[model samples]
Target: MSFKNYISKLVFCNGISNSFKTFTALIINSKRYSSRFKKNTLDLNNNETFVYHLKSGKNKFKFYLRTFKGDIDIFYEVFWRKTYDRHLSFLKKEPVIIVDLGAHIGMTSVYLALKYPHSKIYAIEASSENFELLKVNTEAFKNITCIHAAAYFEDGMINFGNNELSYNQMISENGDPVKALSIETLMRTHDLSHIDLIKIDIEGGETELLSRNNSWLKLVDHTIIEIHTPYTPSDLRDDIQPYGFEIKSEKDSVLFAAKK
Candidate 1:
């Protein structure tokens, strides 16, 4: 690793020690099995939220994290381990357009904004609480436009399950209602002819959106989706194949589809 990356890892690992008990358990169990094993078995206190301000070179990011909510591990993976590093190389030019569905606290949007300085990004989040943080986290970037809405097949209201863990929030029939927007609406609203990339991680809502009339998918050049298992049909690959997108499954629940 480079000196900067080494320092970042050291800082992140050391910073988590503030939650001493949780940190201790993670250490002990991490030796016995894989990190995934520890993640599944560790008992983390969830009563309160924690904030961490992290820096990479001159770029700084503020994360409202909770171990119980798995935000800490996600921050570690995305920022420290560079889990979405592969997505960065897909955009080959400046002034590209990206739509970030399920933007969470705008981490991916921020990363992309910084990496592709000239790109215009629409960061969409469903949860009210997360949208507030998403706005705050991405405010410094002029290219990021944060939207408090869910990406759906239609432009209307939909029920959503809000939770402390932003990633776990999903569209449901029995949760708080939020406004939804279709890809076509988004493109028209933003006055964009085409989107270079659309990154989606809307829990299981992808099944409905992707399975529905996907004529708008033709306007997108690429997509990075995190498909929730079992809930998403196994034929999702086949479903998207006719759109001229070739699917490549990655580690975790991530899938990348590029127009062929």
Candidate 2:
């Protein structure tokens, strides 16, 4: 086999060398940077995007994505470069209440803070490891309040099943071991009446969370959820019609919805 094919077989099958993955990632990032450099040099228009620096490790530096239309987080460059107009269309003028459920590492919070400067964002993350990074990442944004709790259908603390590094946010429905509170109760406790955008990514708990509280529909306007129903037993949209939400868009495992 070819040299590249040999490397792929070793990395894909045996999976012993993380160095292979790191080298591949570096190559991909190099291409992306090259493309960005070419675009910035060529596009000398009135509405050009400028990059900003972020407070992260050398590998993951945050940036300010500035175009003629508006400014957003640089970490969201992929989202902005691909469907910048589509995302911008969702921007609302009125003061919005954003609920970022399962806000892994505060990407959505940081993006929302830059996207909607006047909005109030409550970012909930369960994993202790991720919460640590989320805190530092979102510290500069004053409009955001980071809550380190796993949201669920009930209130109380619960034990989280430790699994893969990314799946650390998954929790039980009732919320024991992992600190959790229902959306309805969270609203009442915080004295929040209107929710402009509620983004939920609680593994496969979307069905249970919605089924338990039909009244939550009245409080939420828009929702972006990551559904994790890969195999049987955990169909993401099995009984979601009662919640009064229409799926607007979906890519990979994430679904965007608007209350109808």
Q: Identify the candidate with maximal TM-score.
A: 1
- Per-residue lDDT of candidate 1, residues 1-260 (tens digit): 57896567666665644455544544443333335435675343343454555445466655554445555555567655777777546645653898999998787888778777788999999988778778888877889999999999888999987543556888877779999988889889889899888888898888878888678887888888888867443566777778788875465677677878
Q: After superposition, how far is residue 39 of candidate 1 from its true place, in Å?
A: 9.7
The true-versus-predicted C-alpha distance at residue 109 of model 2, in Å, is: 0.8
Model 2 over residues 1-260: C-alpha lDDT tens digits?
A: 47885565444323311244443543344345446555664232333333333332222333322232212222333232332234335545543899988877776777667667789999988877667667777777889898888778778776654533343347744433667778887789789998988877777666667666557766777777766665222343444545666666666666666666
Span of 10 residues, lowest total lDDT, candidate 1: 25-34
TM-score of 1: 0.78
Q: Note the clash tally of each candidate.
A: 0, 11
TM-score of each prediction:
0.78, 0.64
